[model samples]
Target: MAKGVWIVAEQRDGALRKVSLELASTARKLADQLGDEVSAVLLGSGVEAMAAELGKYGVDKVYLADNPAFEPYTTDAYAQAITKVVKENDPAVLLLAASAQGKDLAARLVGSLATGMASDCTDVKIVDGKLYCTRPMYAGKCYGEVVVDSFPQMASLRPNVFPLVENAKAGAVVKFEPALGELKTKVVEIQKEASGKIDVTEANIIVSGGRGMKGPENYVILEELAALLGGAVGASRAAVDAGWRPQSDQVGQTGKVVSPNLYIACGISGAIQHLAGMSSSKYIVAINKDPEAPIFQRADYGVVDDLFKVVPALTAEVKKLL
Candidate 1:
C-alpha cells in the first residue's frame, strides 16, 4: 500500500522555489493527520545542498536526484525522473506547487502514472481517511472538492494560498539515480524577464494597474508602491490588451491566476474574467473614480477617486509604514 506524503519540489538555477517550501509545510500537517512521514523530492543538477533547506520546513526525508542533464527544465527528463520516483515509492499522496512548471509536470506525471490528479487546489486535507482537494472551477465561479480513490492520489496546491509553518526536521538525504535516456526536448538557453523581480503568482502582495493609468508610463506609481511593499506588479487584461503592459504581467482568466495576501487594483474595471484570477486573494483594494466599478464590488477597501491622485497618496503612505 502507498504510505507517506511526497512533495515534488520545484527549483531553478540550483535554488529552491518558494512554492517548494510551501508544499513541504502543508504536507507536514497532512502527513501528521495520516500518521505518515513527509518526503520532499528535489531534482536538479548540483542541488544536493538544497535538500538541507527542505529539512527546515518539516520534511522528514529528501530524495535527491542530482545530475547534469537536469540543469534546465526539460519536460522529458524531469518527467522520467519523477515518474521513476513515484513508481518506486508509491506515495499515498503527492503534493506539488501549482506554478507554471509544476502544472506542466503534474499533467505529465499523472498521464504517465495513470493516476488521478486535482489541479490548482486552493485547499487540501485528509477527511475520513481520504485526501479531499478543493479547486476553483468555471473560472473561479465555484469551488469543487474531489477525492481520488486511486493509489498515489496527486494534487497541486495553488501558490501563495497555503501558509508556511517554519518547523525543522532531520530531512535525511537519500541519493537516487534514474535511467533517463537521451531526451527529445532540450533547453538551449533561458531568457529571463524582470530580473530579480518577485514572481507575481508567488508574491504575498501585488499592486496591479489597468486602463485607468491611461498609458504604460503611468505604471511607475504602482511600481513604486509595489517596490516599497516588497511585492510584485500585475495588470488587468485591459492593460495587456491595450499594449500598456506585458502579457506576463496580466492577471485574469486569460492570463496568470494569482492569490496574494494583499491585492491592489488601480484604475481597473473588474470583469468576471479578471476577478476569476484574483478573487482568491486574502484582501483586495480597488481605486477608481467610478463608484460602481465591478472591482469595487469585490474589493475589501474601495477608494472613489481618480487613480492619478490616489496612487501617489497610497504610495507615499506605504513608504511611511516602511
Candidate 2:
C-alpha cells in the first residue's frame, strides 16, 4: 500500500525551481490531511544543497538523484528516475506543479507507470482516504472533481494555485542510483526569453490585458502598470491568438493557469476560459468600461470606466506612491 505524499521537485542548472517549492507547500497540506509525511524527489547534476531548501517546506525526506545526464531535462530520463522513486517509495499521493516541464514530465510518468493522473488541478482535498482533485474541463466552461482509484493518486497542480508555507522540518536526504538508459532525445539548443521579470506563474502580482487594449501598440500601458508593480504581465487568449502577445504570456484554459495574490485584469472581458486560469487569485481587480462585464463577477474590486482614462489614473496613483 502507498504511504506518504511525494512531490517531484523540478530543478534546472543545479538549482530548484520556484514551482517545486510551491508544490512542497501544497503537498504539506495534503500530507496533513492524510496523516502522511511529505517527501520530495529532486534529480539534477548538482542539487544536494536543495534538499535543505525542500525541508523548509515540510519535506521530511528528500530523494536525491544526481547525474549530469539529468540536467538538460530529457523526458525519458526524468520519467525513468521519477518512476523508480515512486515505485520504491510507494507514495499515497504524488504532486507536481503544472509548469511546461512539469506537464511534460507528469504525462510521461503517468504513461510509464500506468497510474491515474489529474492534470492542471486548482485544488486538492482528501475525503475518506481518497484524493479529490478539482480541475477545469471544456475550456474552463465547467469544472470536474475527480477521485483517482489508483494506488498512487498522481496529480499536477496549477502553479500559484496554493499558497506557499514554510514549515521547518529536519528532512533526511536519501541518495538513489538509477540505471538511466541512453536518452533518445537530446536538447541541443536553448533560447531563453529576454525578460528580467519573474516567472509569471510564480509572481505574486499579475497585470493582464485583453482585446480592449485595442492593439499591440497599446500594450505599453499594461507593461507600464506591471513594471510599476514589479510583477509579470499576462494576456488573455484573445490577445495571444491575435498575435499581440506571446503564448507564454497567455493565461486561460488553453494557456498557463495562475493564482497570484493580486490579479489586475485590464480591458479583459472575463471569458470562462480566462476565468478558469485566474479565478483562484486571492484578490481580483477588474477595470473595464462595461459595468456588466463578466469579469466583475469574479473581481474583488471593479472599475466601470474606459481603460484609457482609468488605466492612466491608476498608473498615476501608483507612480505617486512609488
Candidate 3:
C-alpha cells in the first residue's frame, strides 16, 4: 500500500526554489489530515545540505540524490531518478511545483509511473480520505476539481498558490543513488536574462502594462516604477503580440499566471484572459485614463488618469521617498 506523502523539492544552483517550500507546506497540511509523514525528494549535485531548510517548511524526510549527473537538469536524468524513488517508496501522493522544470518532469514521470496527474492546481484538500485538487479549466473561464483514483496520486501545484507555513520538523536526510544512464539530451550553456530580475510568477509585486502604453519605449516609465518597488515587469498579450515586449514577459491565459501580493496594471484593459492569470492577486491597482475600463472594476485602487501623467508622477514621488 502507498504510505507517505512525497514532494519533489526543486532546486537551482543548489538553492531550493520557493515553490518547493510551498509544496512542502501543502504536503505537511495533507499529511496531518491523512495521518502520514511528509517527505521530500531533493535531486541536485550538492543540495543535500539544504534538506534542513525543507524541515522548517514541515518536511519530515529528505531523499537526497546528490550527484554531478543531476547538475544541469536534463529531462531524462531527472525522470529516471524520480521514478526510481517512487518505485522504492510507494508514496500515497507525489507533489511537484507547476514550474517549467516541474511541468516537464511531472508529465514524463506520470507517463512511466501510471498515475493520474493534475497540473497547475490552486488548492488541494482532503475530502473523505481522498486527495481532491482544484485547477483552472477552459482557459481559466472556470474551475474543475479532480480526484486521482490511483496510488501515488500526482499533482503539480502552481507557484505562490499555497502559503508557506513554517511547521518545523525533523527532515531526516536519507541518501539514495540512482544509476542515471547517459542522458540523450544535455544542456551546454544556460543564458539567464535580466539576471537580477525576480521571476514574474514568483515576485511579491508585479507591474504589468498593456497596449495603452502607446509603444515599447513608454514601458520605461513602468520599468522605473517596478525598479523602485523592487518588482518584476510584466506585459499583456496585446503588448507582447505587438512586439513591444518579449514573450517571457507576458501575463495572461496564454502566458505565465501570477498571484502576487500586489499587482499593478498599467494601461491594461482587464481583458478576461489577463484577469484569468492574475485575479488571485491579494491587491490590484489599476491606472487607466478610460473610466469605463474593465480593469477598474477589479482594482482595489483605480486611477482614471492617463498613465503617462500618473505613472511619471507616481515614479517621481516614489523616487523622492527613496
User: Which stretches in model 1 have alpha-carbon errors above 4 Å?
Assistant: none
What TM-score, over all chains together, does every model reach? 0.97, 0.94, 0.96
* Tens digits of per-residue lDDT for model 2, 1-322: 7899999998876678888888998888889998889999888887899999999989999998888878788888899988988897799999988888888888888887778988988889999988999997886677899988896899998877777799998668999989987678888998888849666787889999999988899989888988899889999999999999998899987887888999999999999989978888889999999999999999999999998998889899999999
Instruction: For residues 242-292, write the lDDT of model 3, one tens digit per residue.
Output: 999999889988898898999999999999899888887889999999999
* RMSD of each candidate relative to the true structure: 1.2, 1.8, 1.4
RMSD of 3: 1.4
Every candidate's lDDT:
0.90, 0.88, 0.91
Name the top lDDT candidate: 3
Pairs that clash in candidate 3: none
lDDT of 2: 0.88
Off by over 4 Å in 3: none
